[model samples]
Target: MTVTATRSRAGVLTGVLTAALVCTGLMAGIFFAFTVSVMPGLHETDDRTFVTAMRGINAAIENGLFGLVFVGALGFTGLAAVLLARSGRRAAAWWAGAAAVLYLLVLILTMGVEVPLNDQLARAGDDFARARHDFEGVWVPVNDLRTVLTALALACLGPALAKRTAGVSR
Candidate 1:
């Protein structure tokens, strides 16, 4: 390929990767912060209002099928990165690939472990004690996976951004 054509392709790939990284990074941060800061407090309080909120929150977290969306996004982001890398954006590709792997593993933990536990919790119905027990035992670490995946995405974004800069310079 001509030098100009190669440069143009790289630029486009870099732009797409940058946009994806920024968006995914923002989502990860928002999710992690909400899960960490707010979800915890929901568990700490046991007043009627707190219990109501917890039940509502649990339903929202589980029944909304958020994980399906999350999984889809993760797949798209990884595919984009692969395309970018194949087109010559190695750094961005590497970052996205790493983040994708981490996300996949975390998602697996969510589906295989957390979701079933959520089912158990939901079955507890108005039995707050049983629900809380199940949540504490299983949900906390699943939530921890959320935080870890977010951090992974954030970390990957840094390298992806650097690659964009380097690609522009080259």
Candidate 2:
């Protein structure tokens, strides 16, 4: 390949990796906030208030902006891994790959556990106590797990981005 083409490809890879890092960090922050602040604050509220607030949050968080970052973290990280591997930066690629896997786990837990619980809460009628009982027990722990996974994913991306930069410098 021509020198210009190689440089262009590297630049694109860098952009994708940077995006992956940002999205992953944003996701981590979100989950961390829920873990440290939101859930705990809600936990102190009355059962009816907790159920109402959680249901509202679940509804509000389904917007386009959130979805972009939610899905983008995985997509960009996976693409960066493929691009880095293709460019012969295997070590960096592996790191990116690991980030992708970690984020995938977060996604799996969200879909498999969190979403269903949220749905049940939404349909829970006026039995706020029972709804809170059913939801909080499962949701809080799963969200904590997601928080950790997303943080780990963000951590992996740091080294991957650093390695990519070092490769460029070399």
Best by lDDT: 2
lDDT values, one for every candidate: 0.66, 0.94
- Residue 122 of model 2 has an lDDT of 96
Q: Write the per-residue lDDT of candidate 2 for residues 99-134, one digit (tens) a residue.
A: 999999999998999999999999999998999999
Candidate 1 residues lying further than 4 Å off, grouped into runs, are: 1-12, 47-51, 61-69, 165-170
lDDT of 2: 0.94
Query: 1-170 in candidate 1: lDDT tens per residue?
Result: 89999778767666666655655665577568757787677667774445466557668765334555565547656776777566566776777788777767766776788677666765766777656766665677677777778678667766765664455221
Model 1 C-alpha lDDT versus the unseen true structure: 0.66
* lDDT at position 164, candidate 2: 83
Error of 1 at 117 (Å): 2.4
> CA shift at 152, candidate 1, in angstroms?
1.7
Q: What lDDT does candidate 2 reach at residue 37?
A: 100
